[model samples]
Target: MTEVELTMSQRLRCLVIGIPQATFPEGLLRPDEAASIPYAQLAEHLPLPDTLELVVAPLFCDDFDALEIIETLGSAGYRRVLRIVAPKLPNRQIVLRELRSHAVRQGITLEMVEEG
Candidate 1:
């Protein structure tokens, strides 16, 4: 697919992490628009895209888990901004602080959006 094939119109490739296909919100994205990879299959999707949109539950993010996610993104070679979509977290400040540092070292700009 990376053979530089010609297309009449531009295509938008969006890869979603930390969300499962079945449980993913319905109206937000169509079946073909994005691929929602569950946590188990995260590292298995090889030839990883340089950019990805992570859809994770903030409640699941603690200091250690957040670090693991950040390291995986770096190892996968995502050198651009990462847009994270999730609901507000009770301990957002603490988690954000931890992630911010690791994200910076990976050359990743973290944009957190409160999902509706």
Candidate 2:
């Protein structure tokens, strides 16, 4: 999203999945609007997000973990896009296509982005 669009979307809640809490990239998120969760703790209950909810996760994780994250987010009442950030991933076209289809079926939008 463009900077102006993001600024317009108030309280853009985000869940940084599996990334260490310490590496949450300070200043990238407004304190009240974001949090990082360990993959192991994903089973815990999460509040239904208000407005847009952006989920940041690694694309290189085990396939099951990726699917599980989607399921968990859906179960937690997340109804917006899950924006996964990865620097690089193999078989990008195939992976993105498959995941996009699955994400759509679960009533979630999937957006994959590469970042270093």
Candidate 3:
């Protein structure tokens, strides 16, 4: 008899911070076409990367303080913090914000990525 081998896939979750007010390739889609699609629909078209956990409490302002909420989420199930940088955001503010969170008491570090 021959032995059978099998492989298992791991499920990964990732948090998407800062829902962009606008999208790239502007003017490519007609206003009607753009307005027709929903976030869930968009997610299907553009799949998230592997090894992501969850994105919690998107802070619009760099000065917004939500450490408790963030820490709670991090402790619950989150393993990594992924920061999304977009042209619409203030570059200096983002950098400063990242620096502030770098000193998290719970030892959570936000990894900033230029692109999703």
lDDT for each residue of candidate 2 in 8-59, tens digit (9 for 90 to 100):
4466577666666335568876765666656765554245447556788876
Q: Return whichever of 2 and 3 wins on lDDT.
A: 2
Candidate 1 residues 7-85, lDDT tens each? 1112324555554432446787554445655555665565454333443423243332545666777777766656565
Residue 29, model 2, lDDT = 68
Winner by lDDT:
2
- Residue 78: error of model 1 in Å? 1.0
Model 1 has how many clashing residue pairs? 0
Sorting all predicted structures by lDDT, with the top scorer first, yields 2, 1, 3
**Candidate 3 error regions (>4 Å):** 1-10, 17-57, 61-69, 84-103, 112-116
| Segments in model 1 whose C-alpha atoms lie over 4 Å from true places | 1-12, 21-33, 50-64
Clashes of each: 0, 0, 5
Clashing pairs in 2: none
* Model 3 C-alpha lDDT per residue in residues 29-59, reported as the tens digit of each score: 3322222122233233233333444343333
lDDT of every model, 2 decimals: 0.54, 0.67, 0.39
Q: Which candidate number would show the highest TM-score if scored against the true structure? A: 2
Q: List the residue pairs that clash in candidate 1.
A: none
